[model samples]
Target: MFKMKSKSTLLLMLLGAVVGSLGVTSASAEKARIVNTGKHVDNLIHKVDIRNLSYFDTRFDYSSKPYKMSQNRYQTYKLKRSLKIANMNKHKEVILPKGSVVTGLNDGKGNITYISNPSLSLKNQKLVFKTLGNWHGSLPIIKNNGGAQQPYTRNTAFSYKSSAMLPFLSVKSNKPFYDAEGLSLPFVSISADSQLIYHTKGSKYKPTRYAKIKKFKLTHSAITYYLAKPVKGVATKKVRSGKTHLYRATFKMGHVFQMMFADNDTDGYSLTVNNGRQEFFISLYQLGWKYVGSIVGLTGADAVSPTDAKIATDYVQGLY
Candidate 1:
């Protein structure tokens, strides 16, 4: 009887051991599968011409000013695009976290706009989205120079609005970085009171461009903005065949967000934009990370007064 009881105990222990091993193996395999799948998707995207697979839905009002006090109206635009990342391996739909939805807004002028919330726009239509995940990332930084990666990036809902207009494109930040040093990143706003009116290179060339207006109805939101350089364009065609034409404008990837991309990496505060135009332009002062406050307004170096310039500088420098 004693021998039989001892055998039964040994069998049960062995069974428990087997189950534990299997659990570990299963978890490891699942992780590997997800990694491999992500890699496969990346590779396929590289091989394909992204233009063929991607489409953007855009809507905006055309006007000549940022704030239209005469009409009591504001100019705006909204576009949403789904980039099909081709993958050979099957991928489960990735549901981004509550803050993972990436969004952007830009005017055709010098003002870049970011809308943190999608549902706030009263003028523009909602973006046509299929997959999950917003345009989200942070500025990149190296380890040796590490301090608190200041202006940490966060997923905030916002609405975008601005007066700047130029060719622009959205990009992902390669590493953790901060914007005060002056690297170009996406600029955004919660609502735009400005409108892109004209594109002028010289007295010889000019085009009358305007944006349709939209209004956002949200109360709380966030905005991100990006600056675009190295624009591409083709000379405009002449119908009369006598006058020299302007050009058909286009833009390429200039720079991504200055904020470094990390998981809740921001220690202080930072800013970003969501949707942008192909050819957007802006001044230097407006090109840094900004934080939105509840009562005061947008916070950043610009928001900081002359008295607080030193404080803002120190705060930005500490981000590095």
Candidate 2:
């Protein structure tokens, strides 16, 4: 019996070593640093949703009145890229198949992974696209040697969530797109609860404007807000030919939560253990936001649901 037990233990040890080696090899293999190639489509979207436990719903209809843009006389430049980073500690790169579709994923060093693919796999819930490029921008943050302005410091301050507004379709601007002051399209406002939330891409309109989000902090749990002053020139110019949209925007929101009581203004990605897994996230892509893919280190219940991924991919791809 002792001999048999010893042999079994030895076998288990060998198996463990082999598994460990494979895991390490996988990590290194993924580190070759493949990036996004912007040959395909580049786009952005605004995903809005309140934190919930059940599912990601995108259909957002704020019944008051349709939000419109305030006419302004300024240069409006659209973004050339959109990115999202899912903080994951693993080897697997959120693989996107090859095609015309644009993709986004997150990995180490806060890198945005984009895979431009043509055909998606209905069988697998993976984003189908070719391995494109990686993007990095400079923005202020609350971290060490970051931005000095902690705008969301007050408990009542609004949290800016993640959203990218890519003009999917554009019409010729025979006439200048203007508003009241002729300020060149000033702000993008969304109406909610009879209140208007205003945002701009940049302060002064430039030919090409890139608003890099250095840091996002939230305060209170009532309502979050996103504001930016983007340029106005691009909105007047012709978008990409053949392509429907020219620019892409990205939005992300972060806050600290505890118990059923939520605290909006906090610092960093905080995990609250007091409550039953408090969830705080911003959705702007669609009315019924759906999960498509995920990074590693996710536990049970958090496992990537392939069924939902296929449905969303099919639905979005059909639109293009």
Candidate 3:
């Protein structure tokens, strides 16, 4: 009997040992899973957000009206040798494309004169020529109306100019000119050697009058801005002190954001944040000095990783 009792106690001790071992194994597995999940979250948070910088201020105000992001106006044009001359006698009027440049005109005579000044008209398509000399017959007018001979064919050889005109006196003043009204104008070139001044005109007017003989000193003070190098990865963290918090908000994954700033009085810059699939835009007076925000497109309720949020928040704050 004493031996049997001792054996029973031994059996119970072995069973307890086995149960304890199983419990330890299960707990270890659960702990390991939690650790791995934490690591994954950290990785997602650190992932970089792609950034594209632009010199144009692409932010718009939509407080009173529904906001719509502007579509890209960039076009691809194929270069062609010659364009069809418009036959005015057929009562056929050809309007040039908005951005087309007229380098030369068919003087309504047989001769095509390669003149220095070119006119670019944005609104009208009719190519009308003020006769320089009576040919006694209708001349062959080169149709500069913005028709693509073939799809995407653009003749850039002609000096193309913007339709918006700047006052001749303002350009000659040699002082920095700002289109306070945000008007787009053609590039103006003043001759350093002669009093000849040339500007771009549209096909609506005569080509010869495009060039002007005016006296003005050459000034190299014209100001322009170019796009800065794009930044990759998330924004760094830096806190700024101001009355308004520029970029303090929760954003979901795939949300897009843009920050626009004026580097100087004459130049502007834009920073775009492409998060997941959604895009958002923000236009600021100075980096973070003053700003207005808008939605670039539709967004959803997907939560973004903490790291991405931090990176984006820190980047905008760093700019300030």
Candidate 4:
């Protein structure tokens, strides 16, 4: 997405995903669309209404180790030694005592944990600064200090629902495209939703003008994805390769639920759990949006346990 003009700009980050991340993949310049079109191929769809109470069942505890939980959404974790901390929102750094107990919620992107300090007078004062990368790999939040903003905050802490979501929906659209040589191309596409996803390399795209987008449907579950209205997406920039239909949408469950798309990127509809902040990008002439809508749809915008990740993965994998 060309430094989207709105929300300041939704800087695009290709997930380098599982099935569909904002990451890029290599492929022949040739472009083509599958003969079959419409209704997203039902054969690839494994139907199980996410609405079923069964889907929420943490059916499998993938971990043998004990994981802590909170009376609410916040879970418990311990620091073996004193750890340096900062408040992303306030830019004030603090140090937690050795053996400091932190309580909070996470969605992988913005894993915010805080020590209940009796000394701190302000309620918001307890906010702890922890980036996804610091805790693990290149996990991400929003732009500089956007802080952890929970969407369900207005009512009972984002409903204790968030995402470690996306993917699982699968990219099943038959994108008809032509390379500079005017050749039809085939790339890796993963079917996560209504029966399919089609891709040759499992990433990125260089788009033709939005000359004509055949009418197709965005299938996959976004069940109560915010427990309400789907986050409205923003049509970002119009790139040089003839307008990569770049767009973004966000809602909070407990964590940030941000979804990005580049009809030109073939990365399909990938996502990232941030601090309810949106800023990502896909290089020009690379990536594609196969339109996977919402996969596991969790975003764990407050991604806490691998448990949430597992549940989403299992359901998408048809285990649910």
Candidate 5:
């Protein structure tokens, strides 16, 4: 009976040890699964290293070359004394630090001094200065014997001419004049008494050689002339014989006018008219009739007239 009881106790002890081992193995498996899942989620959502990206290709190349000492006649130097007692009577040799710049040197021996302008980091245990030209780590001294030249006087009388008609016509005129093309005709003239009188240049019976068929004026700006009408007749016809029409009527500032094309597509044109203002631009656009689309404003330096603006737009669209 005693032997059987001892046998039963030993069996129970062995079973407990086996159960504990299996529990430890299950816990380890669970911990490993959690660790692997965390790593996979981090890799899927987070950026590991930005520097490893393919877009970054530029790198700084550190040079390993030594600095050269200046050989100027009036350069500064430091003395190197002899350590041996027998060589104490000999003259001490002068030495200069690496990358020492000789700015202003004196002739006397006691006044010798060296100036070093080194960067934040040193190279080869020596002072390193910023350099230009080749990256071979050589600093070449350049001397300018000739002093700075005197500034040339500018011509104050010279004035820039704008390509716009308004800028050209706004200048003070001594007398009434006509444009070379005869398209710009002075319709009305004011005398010293401020009385308005009809101009003979655009008269129906006695028209000028290049008489304009239509004229445009700023309605809100006290009747200031803007641009002449565009010609529509055949290209072979003469200037006087070609038919001209007013494409844009007299409208106020910021008023857009639509021009219909043969393909049913239309373009818009508007003038930003302002009194006593030297700067102005014409806005053009490609859109449907009565619908304002994307507009591009052309400056006076670009186009001065409706015809010029149309030609510019056509050229940009590769129509030319």
Candidate 6:
């Protein structure tokens, strides 16, 4: 009886060992699969045109080869940080948790007017789309130096309003990076009560360059504003025929964007007008990466400040 029991015990132990081995192998395979997925995505990045992709969405920030870039906004644009909301009307303002999938309901120019979550909305049957972002412009510092294998390149967001619009691409940094000298970089914010009124609805430079305003809208302090009809036209060198019309959106405020395509050249704007009340022309020249020069507000040139001129003149940096 003792010998028979020992034989049975031996058989059972051998079976258990085999089963454990199989389980271990299965776990190893799953880990290998995950690793391969990261590699597969990283490999595809090398073969595509980077410009067509939104900077934060597709582009990787790598300074060397054997690029390690998979955890970017490659899949979807998610909130890196939580945005708080205190809705006075609905009494249902909740902090949007990190990693909320941002749905598309924008001004077609990356200006997210609102984000809708029906589950979060109550009382009002309509899905209350609290604004996902207010364009707070930014200034970023690149880790640039000689002898570095890969110096950081220009990768700013397409929109002028950024949490950082440096180089006008979508890259975010919570804290300013320090140079080799350990000096903290400075930040620039042209935040002002500014406005811009221009139209890009006309896709052609036809017999008469005209666009009935419809594409863009400005939201300031929870109040949205649209461009009124053009009351009069003005002459400017920015346009070829000098037929810049002042579409009626009076902005004593600062810079605001007029929408454009990814590869379209900037359109011109007439001076800021107030139905013959006030006329000011502001012009800004983007000399280079971090240099914006001049703000001329006059009768025929429409701009409130230097930042307004910079944004109104060159809002489409083409990073989208």
Query: Which is the leading candidate under TM-score?
Result: 4
lDDT of residue 247 for candidate 4: 22
Please give, for residues 260-292, the per-residue lDDT of candidate 4 as tens digits.
223332322222112134321211111111111
Cα lDDT for residue 253, candidate 4: 17
lDDT of each: 0.22, 0.21, 0.22, 0.24, 0.21, 0.22
lDDT of 6 by residue, 1-320 (tens): 01112322442353221000001111111111000113332223222222222222222113435433222111112444444443313244445544433321222233322332221212211222333221111111111211112111322221222211111111111221111011121211110112111211111101122223222333221111222233232112121213543333322222222112232212121111111233222111111111111222233232245543353224323321
Candidate with top lDDT is: 4
Off by over 4 Å in 3: 1-126, 129-197, 200-206, 209-320
TM-scores of all models? 0.18, 0.18, 0.20, 0.24, 0.16, 0.17
Q: Which stretches in model 6 have alpha-carbon errors above 4 Å?
A: 1-65, 68-126, 129-320
lDDT of 5 at 94: 22
Consecutive 10-residue window with the lowest summed lDDT within model 1: 17-26
Q: Which ten residues in a row have the lowest lDDT in candidate 2?
A: 17-26
- Model 6 collision count: 21
- Supply the TM-score for candidate 6: 0.17
Looking at model 4, residue 187 earns an lDDT score of 26
Better of 4 and 6 by TM-score: 4
lDDT for each residue of candidate 5 in 2-75, tens digit (9 for 90 to 100): 11123224423532210000011111111110011133222321221211111111111113233211212111
Better of 2 and 3 by TM-score: 3
Q: Can you write out model 2's per-residue Cα lDDT over 6-80, one digit (the tens) per residue? A: 322442353321100001111111212111112121121112222221112122222324421111101011122
Mind sharing the TM-score for model 4? 0.24
lDDT for 307 in candidate 1 is 26
Q: What does the lDDT read for residue 50 in candidate 5?
A: 15
Ranking by TM-score: 4, 3, 2, 1, 6, 5
Write model 3 residue lDDT over 237-313, tens digit each, in one string.
Answer: 22232542221111122212121122212111122222223222221222111221111111232233343334333
